[model samples]
Target: MSLRADLRVLWRSPGFRRLTWTRLLSQGGDGMFQVGIATAFFFDPTTATSPEQIAVGFAVLLAPFTLVGPFVGPLIDRWQRQRILLVGNLVRLVLAAGIITLVLADAPVWSLYATALLTLSVNRFLLAAMTAGLPQVVPAHQLLAANAVLPTLGTIAASVGGAIGGIATFVVPSVSDNSLAVTALICAGLAFGASSIAATRISRKELGPTHPLEKLDVGAQLRALTAELLEGERYLRARRTPWHALGVMSAQRLLYGLVFVASILASRSILADPDDAEAALGAFSIVLGFAAVGFGLAAVITPMLGDRVSRERWILICLGIGAVGQIVLATAPTAWALLTAAIIVSFAVQGGKIAVDTIVQRDTEDHVRGRAFTLYDMAYNVAFMSSAVVGGLILPDSGWSRPIMLGIAVVYVLVAIVFARTPHEVRPVPPRPVAN
Candidate 1:
């Protein structure tokens, strides 16, 4: 079906519209929230110093999720997803407010970390609910199109939100740490209001796997979840193509994370006044905007290129793009150069992500697909967190190192070569729906 026709169908479906609104509100808030956090971490001269500190921040942000995933999946399956979406957003709203207060009070670092962790945990839960509920609202046939459009829109919303938060820093005090703290508070309010309104638009049970026959006992749910996870692992083992695709994506994320650490260091210590948090944040914001554009372009181009190329070949091409991008950064290492590199690298990473997701959907059975995706999520997060650890050990406080950049380039090229050697017949799969 044509894009316009797909949108028309979505517009007519009240349920889909409500879900889309929910996703947009939540993800948009996420973007702003991230910007606010970045402002505090890298932009604020007071808190910004040392790769180890940055590494700890990254760990606080992502690594604990590895421990949280097993519990999240079982809870997501057993709970009413609509309630999850509503309650999750509400919880995040409170957490955001708490973070803002903590920042204002100049609270201890651990206190801030605790709040951030809880906020992110709720954010992940809300996103999972959004994905699980998607198929419930749209027709099965339109599932593919709905999946593509809604999530992309949500991503765009997030990019816009981040951009707005970045702008807030420039207009507000411009020199005070309180500026970013205020931005975080404003974003928290936006999340609270939008989510509350969106929640009211949908019926409680509209989005569900509502396992009618299952017992609701906690032990039963845990046992079922363990079995399901094991089943997903076995499924991936049997399917080399999807498994390989996942490996490719995981490698890309690790590389991307390393590059990101480099970017942060470069932005914090090299690009602008190291002590001037606002200046560093403003510069970082511009770079982030460029990266978002790259991600947007990837979304646009993937649909156009998906049918024309084999998924395997496309993955190789993206890795090549990344390798080339790293080389560009290595040689120039300026803000503009960083922007240029961000565009290409982000494009490459997002493209690989699209290809891998398509592979999973095409190769996996529908019943176990959710679990498969949960595992997929875990792989990338773990890879990303691992990169922070690796990068922290090797990267300087300034975040710029020629050797590391060169090493990243080499890794990309080698991964591409390894992928090329894998002997899977190339098959084209249409882009599947994704939730951010």
Candidate 2:
């Protein structure tokens, strides 16, 4: 089906529309929250002057959640998904208030980080629930289109939200950095509250594990969770398509993260005056805006080619495109070049992500789908975090390294070649019997 027709079908479904709105509001708030952090923490000349500092900031934000991410999967499977969505946002709303307080009080930085950590941890669960519940709302036949459209739209919403936050910081007269960041956080908190309200519109059990697990004693629950996670690992290993797709996606994300860090440093040190932190922030936001355009293009292009090309083949094509973008960055490390590369590589990453999401959702059973997506999120974040570490170690404060860019381009090509050669078909694993 064409993209328009697929959207028409999905729009008619009340469940899909509600779920989409929930994601948009939630992710939009996430974007605002993150930009506020960047302005207050990262782009601030006093706080982050070196690549190591930037990497540490990301590690503090992401590493804790990545470590504990697996525990969330089983709960997602066991809990009422609608309740998770509703409660998750409410929790974030409360956390945002705490963060705002810390920012205003000029409290210890660790205190601010701690509050942000809790907010992001809840965010992980909320996102996983949305991805797992997608199958329940849309028709089986339209899953691919839904995947292409929904996530792409959500990403665009985030970019728009971030742009708004950036403008908020600049537009308010005579506002301090702390006050501007607080403004963004206030907006984010309101958005989270609104998202929770949207979540209430979806009926309980509308997005489901058709059969939820029974409550258990703490020890028994721990044992069952371990066993279930093992079983999920085995299931994914047995499904070659989703597993391979995940590997390729992770590779791309890793490289993208490297470029991401470079872009930040480049904006701060090379593109804008090093003394002017707000100017650097504006430059980075422009890069993100171009990247958002890439994401939008992928949404339109992926669905248009859905009928003519297999998703697996499309992934390979995207990786190839990413290689070209990386090559462009390596050869010409200018502001315009970075912006052009951002558009190309963001398209590649977003396109490949849409394909990977569809593959995992289509292949995994609902009983374990929550776990599957949690694993997906883990890999995604870990790859990005790892790249930040690597970029910190290898790149200079200026964030321009031709050799590293060329090397990343080479890796992208190699991954595409390896993925194309790998066998995709595997014997299906029967679903494990659920214990009473």
Candidate 3:
């Protein structure tokens, strides 16, 4: 009954409906685009590429965030948020379609890098705009609920889209000839759909002033963004609690990447059969979807429990769960054992991520949030990228997978120690005046 009531309340909210629906379509498109591109890559005549090449392709797609991210956050503060979103979606539609064209034409692989970069850079910009706008649209009371639900939905989309994408590659033998083109068209269609829905439903009149595009002298804007991003740096340092929280979370990301290395390498070594490979990845994806939805729900519920306990306490507990799960995988002796461990790890890690998102959202301010979160995103990407770089050098048939997984567990524990020392309260409230 309570869930129904919550649903009714959510359903009745015009802003929530528009925001969720738009995000659903757009984010689904984002997920599908990821899937489609991977498929295209496999079919590209340049299949002889390096193992890290695929990683590089995806990394290039995400790398722009680090370069322009600091600026993006401030831009979110300066512009009318919806307009920024509108422009981003439209530009992406073109880029997605263009990528498809180049792929089908069998254009040089060098070309794909630029397309990926453009698509993701615009995505980062739009993502910043959306993050700043969400608080404005939802009732303050439901903010946490809203945040939890959307990411939940997005994660589910990612899992499903990945599955669908893999299947598309398997089933569509002819898809390779124009796989990139097909990916582009589908992405464009999704973008167009999302744009139409948002344009019709979003309340343009309600938008608050942000730094307008014309005033965004790119150079000066970059400087201002740097300043704003720095504002939070002092806050991060002064309040050891939040810094501790960020540290654990950052370490979690690093270990999380390591865990992936452990799993992929384990699977290849232990169950290298062609038939088992697909089954393994598929099983992981399906379980991940379930895990994603569970975590998403937990995130919404977490805020309800927010007043009762410290975020650090929650993170500490979750990290411990995660560390144990990591150990389980590292030491698992068989494929089934590894699968069991993977499921538990997925549950723990995904749940922890949900809480982290909520923590960051609640802790940070809108004005500097884009820069802050973008840096947050950068830290996340960098950790994983660094792990991959290490893997290429250190990875060998001799199997260092267990050692790596154990290392991840150690990183998590060390991070938790730092978090445990952090004070219980650190949500940046303004300084109060002394009573005279």
Candidate 4:
């Protein structure tokens, strides 16, 4: 079927529609929340804008999840996913309010970070639940199209939300940075509340674990967590296609993270004056805007080609596109060049991601799917975190390094070649039935 027809079919399903809305709203709130934090933390005039400082900020946000993410999967597998969706957003709603209050009161930076960290940690659960529950909403045959469309839409929603937050920062005349951040946080809290309401529209059992877990004592379940996680790892390793797809996705994320850090630094120092935090934020927002356009294009293009080609082949094509984008930036190192590269690389990364998500969702069993996705998230964050560290060490504060950009391009090309050579034949696992 064509991408349009696939979407039409998906839209006909009530479950798919509700789940999509839930994802869109949740991710939109995430975007707004992140913008508020960025304005307060990274783009603040008082903050030290350095590669090392940026790396540390990323570590502080992501490292906790990396350590705790594995334990989340088993609970997702055991609990009612619908409840997770509802309760998670509700929790974030409260956290968003806390953040707003902190901004208003001039709370300690550590206190603000603590609250934001809690908000994001809950966010991790919400995302994993959505991914794990997706196969339940649509037929297995449409997984690719669903994956292609849903996530891309969510990303676009996030971009829109971020833009709104950015606008909020500048709406008032002579607005203090704290006031601007507070305005954005208020908006974010509203989004989170709306997302929670959307979650309530889906039926309690609509997104499922299929088989209910045998009841276990709290102590027993905690003890079994390690064993279950190990079992999940074993299952994923046994499924070679998903395993290899994940490895490719991780490589793409790592490269993307490196570029991401460079873009931030460049936007702050090279593209705009370092001392003018507002101008730096504006520059960075423009880069993200271009990247959002790329994400939308990938949403359209990936589905169109999905029916015509194997996902593995499409991933290779994406990596090649990424290499081309990086080469452009490496050669030019200008504002227009950076924006152009942002578009191309964003398309490549998001395209590859859609394919990988479909592969992992389609190949893994439903019971173990939650664990599969959590593992996927872990790898995803770890790769990005590692890249931030590497970028910190290698990139100059100006974020213009021909050698590093070229090196990234080379890595993309090599990964494409190596991944294409590897045997990753399309192997469709039979779809499991959803419990009514």
Candidate 5:
């Protein structure tokens, strides 16, 4: 089906539309929240002067939740997902308020980090629930198109949200950190409000594990969760298509993370003033806007491309293109080059991601889908942390290193070759009997 037809089908499905709105708002809020942080840490010379500081900021934001989310994935499968969506958004709303308080008070960095950690931890569950719940809103045949359209739209929403937040820094009359924090608070409120309202539109049981849940003592519950996680791992090992797709996606994300950190450093030190927060933020936002254009184009093209070639082949091609983007960054290392590279890499990443998501959702059983997505999220966040660690060690204080960028480009090319060679046949796994 063409993209337009798929969109028309989706438009007619009220359930899917509600879910999409929920996702779009929350993701956009995420983008705005992140922009606020980027402005504070990367653009503000007082807070973030060196790559070490930059790396540490990310570590603090990501590390704790990364450790906690995998263990919590099974709960998403066990509980009603609609409730998770509703409650999770509320929790984030409360946490966002706390973050605003801390920022306004100029509280200790640890306090701000802790509050942000809780907000993000809840976000992990919300995202897992959203992805897992997708199969419920759309039919089996529409799943591919839904996956391509929904997530791509969500990415664009987020990019727009971030851009809006960036513009707020200039419009608010005061370019202080407090003004950014206020902008973030408003975005968070809008996000939580829209998502919560949308979540209520779906019946509580609509997005389900139609499988029965077992009543167990606390110890038994722990054991069951552990066993279920193991089962998910084994399930992935047995399915060649999803396993290979996930490996390739994970590798790409890891390399992309490296590029991401490099871009931040480059924006702060090379493209704009290291000491001027607003100038630096403006420059970075322009780069982000260019990348958003790429994301929008990818959305339009990926579905059309997927129709012509096998998803695996398309993924391979995206990886190859991504390597070229990295090479551009390595050789040129100018503002325009960075912007151009962002556009190319953004296109490649979104295309590959759409393919990977479809592969995972199509191959996995609904009962375990939440856990599967959680694993995917874990891989995604861990790779991001790895890049931060590597960036901290290797990137110069200026955040510009031709060698590091070139090395990442080489890795991308090699991974693409390996991904192309990997077998992608669908191997069905026998369903294990569920204990009543």
Candidate 6:
């Protein structure tokens, strides 16, 4: 393709712009949800410290993603992805309202947890739809560049939401209940607006030959669902690729889980500003956001470098950078030092998204993209889930010390080793440029 054609095909495309705007809204809301919930759980007067209660509340939100994997993946493949995205975002309006009202009413904590989980589940599913939709929107040639830019935008939105949410928790009155409610409502409103804008701009014509769904037996469908739920693991067990990638991603997330638990403990123990826990939490994110700024810069550069580097090369480089950064995070002596390390870690870690995602997009087929990407999503989530469950058992007794950090570091190194040894069969091959 000529340079002019490439530019018009990607940059001038209406579908591309719509995808960008909607992603910003969705991820911004994600940052709002996390901050809102943390406020309710950590700072809200009505929250209790019962260990079981904390587990249950957090699990309830995460559970829907785990359980819904089977149905959601098949649905993304079987439906018009944009339609699903529009409907899903619009519906969150009600889900957000419900949680906000319950928080205000001081409803049973279980109700609040359940509502948050449902809203988040819906959010997770729509996110999957969007991921699966991208390749369909852009020509295969532009996949790498599109993947890099969209995710960078989402990171930016998340940082904005987190910072704003943190500040909102402090500034808003009647915030004991209404603060999160207001945040949720804004998120939902933006979601609806985003979906509508996308509807106007994106032509349904480019979506490729629509594969209509066929009916299946109830028992057979159940069996298929069970298989799909375990499909990612099965894929790994049967193949050489995904499991290695999974190991890398899982170890990284396990470290992240430890980081979260450790940061919480470190704020109280090491920093001794137990009362300023909020700032410590904010500090962690602020530093990470600054790092995301670096990722955003890379996003801009990746397109220019697109012809120069293979996507797989970028993945290997990013993973190495991330693993080393995690080591710095584990050993950093002070909160400010950790924050500085965080800036570095964030840049290294985020580059993984575009690289990893491009690999999946190029490697997986359109027919199976939904299942493939959803399973990847599940792998990433289940990694965190497993880490949380296992770490929860270990961290409380261990007191957020080196035991957790070093262990996670070792896991990351192992992941790096395995991925390094992984063969090229499944790795993405960069597209060849056309001579003018």
Task: Give the top-scoring candidate (lDDT).
Answer: 2
Candidate order (lDDT): 2, 4, 5, 1, 6, 3
* Per-candidate local distance difference test: 0.75, 0.87, 0.60, 0.86, 0.80, 0.62
Model 4, poorest ten-residue lDDT window?
427-436
- Model 3 alpha-carbon drift over 4 Å, by segment: 1-9, 39-61, 139-141, 162-176, 179-184, 205-216, 239-242, 272-308, 393-400, 427-436
Q: Which portions of model 5 miss their true places by more than 4 Å?
A: 101-107, 163-180, 212-219, 433-436
Displacement of residue 134 (Cα, Å) in model 2 is 0.4
User: Once all C-alphas are superposed, what RMSD does model 4 give against the true structure?
Assistant: 3.4
In angstroms, the error of model 3 at 376 is 2.0
Runs in model 2 deviating more than 4 A are: 1-5, 104-106, 167-178, 214-219, 433-436
Q: lDDT per residue, candidate 2, 1-436, as tens digits?
A: 6567778888999999999999999999998888867765579898889899899888887897787787766777888799899999999999999888888889997898788888988898898999999999998778889998898878877877777776787786646768877888888899899999999999999999787655646666666776777777788888877788889989999999999999999999888987799799889888988988888788878988888988899999999999999999988769888999999999999999998898899888888898888889889989999998998899989998999899999999999999999776755898776442
Candidate number of the best TM-score: 2
* Clashes (candidate 2): 0
TM-score of 5: 0.92
Tens digit per residue, CA lDDT, model 5, 155-230: 7787878777767767777767478667767776677778888889888888886653545366666667767777
Order of candidates by TM-score, top first? 2, 4, 5, 1, 3, 6
lDDT of 3 by residue, 1-436 (tens): 2333455676687776776766666766676677655433322324303335434543554467666666666666566777776767887887877877776788897897788676777766766566657666666566555555666665666555555555555565463566634743564457546764585578763443333454556776666666666666666556445455556666777666655554454444554432344443444344344445446546555555555655667777778877787687677546655666565666566556656665666666555455556666667667766665555455543233567667767777877787777676765556322211
- Scored against the true structure, residue 166 in model 2 reaches a CA lDDT of 67
Please give, for residues 105-213, the per-residue lDDT of candidate 6 as tens digits.
8799789777778778887887788888888778787987777777777877876776676566566665354564666555555654565466545555344225735
Task: List the lowest-lDDT window of 10 residues for candidate 3.
Answer: 42-51
Cα lDDT tens digits for candidate 4, 1-436:
5557778989999999999998888898888888866765567767647888888878887887787788766778888898889988999999989887887888898898889898888888888999999999899878889998888878888888887887877885545767877877788888888988999999988899887565746786777777777777777777778888999999999999999999989998878989999899899989988998888788888888876888899999999999999998998768999999999999999999999999999888888888888888899999999988998999999888999999999999999988888768645444333231
What does candidate 4 score on TM? 0.92
TM-score for each candidate, following the candidate numbering: 0.84, 0.94, 0.82, 0.92, 0.92, 0.80
